[model samples]
Target: MPLPYSEKVMEHFRQPRNVGRIEDADAKSIEGSPACGDMVAVYLKVDRESLRIDDIKFESYGCASNIATGSIITELAKGKTLEEAKHITWKQASEALGGLPPIKTHCSILAVDGLRAAIENYEERHGLIREHKPTTIEVIRKRLKRVMNPMVGLDLVRTKVVKDIEIADGVVRVAIDLPADHQFAANIREEISEKIQPLWDVQKIVVEFTE
Candidate 1:
């Protein structure tokens, strides 16, 4: 039997870089979930004067690809200015590791998202963030695309699991096409909340199922 991963992927999995948390990290963000078995927490130490990522680290809870992606992204982001690091996409991270299986591509998404989220946190805390426009259904739907369905490893939007979306009075309501008792239902619901809860204009999130 042969491994599906590239040599670079295997190398990073065996010896992932920056594999721990920073005690006083300037900014940190956790993405994915335990239920999905693919969570990653990214920590960043930025040079405020230069707005550069002085150091970066990650802790991952997932498979080989997940660990490998996390390692590669941290390596790629280190020493880059936040503006530059924010341009580190999942595809770029995957290519850096030779490439990942299509099924495992979501791992790279999680890794890149974790890094970008940490950068966003740093910017928000340092008042470097831009003023967000009013949140709308399109904004909510776009964010939902990042919420992967654990069953297929694809986002809710792409999998067509998201049936509908609505917002009123600062509350966002999402209707997903899954049985309320489906095994992955809880995971999906939690993923949706994580993705939508960060909207500046969203005061609350409501996820409901529609079989």
Candidate 2:
């Protein structure tokens, strides 16, 4: 069978742009994990006056799709203002690359996530982020959608693996429908914490397995 990837995907994978770290970056983020066999790191240098991304780069540890997505995402975010870059989506990244396989769609998601996280970090550092809003279960669930299940290369929320979510008094509890000893259980838990821990109002996080 022919390769499933498009020509754009192959080209980017072969010579991914911005494939290193920016040691004095204005902001940076690293997402994904070795357990998933995929990780992406993003760094940015923003023009504080214009709030534009003066420079952007990425380092990816994963498949061809992962590297390609990272390359395309940085190209899309560079020269854009923080507000504009925040709107860059995984679909846009995949489309820019001509498209990715259905099974590898999460690669785009991971790449876009790294970009957004870096932007958020910059905003937080420069006091551009808005004041804290009340945390809700719905918000928590929405964020959980970004936590992919390594076994399936799909998010836990989309796969219906997030059995329950509860929040009260600054504490958030999440119940995942996986065996406690499952190979990716710890990785999933860590991803869940990373997603929720950023909330200003979330003082604690508790993840439990419900197998």
Point to the candidate with the largest TM-score: 2
Over 1-91, each residue of candidate 1 has an lDDT whose tens digit, in order, gives: 7689999999999999999999999999999888777999999999989999999999999999999999999999999999999999888
State the lDDT of candidate 2 residue by residue for 153-185, as single tens digits.
778899998888999899999999999999888
At residue 54, candidate 1 shows an lDDT of 95
Against the unseen true structure, what C-alpha lDDT does each candidate score? Answer: 0.89, 0.90
Worst 10 residues of 2 by lDDT: 124-133
Relative to the true structure, candidate 1 reaches a TM of: 0.93
Alpha-carbon shift of residue 30 in model 1 (angstroms): 1.2
lDDT score at residue 22, model 1, on the 0-100 scale: 97
TM per prediction: 0.93, 0.94
lDDT of 1: 0.89
Relative to the unseen true structure, what is the C-alpha lDDT of residue 76 in candidate 2, on a scale of 0 to 100? Answer: 93
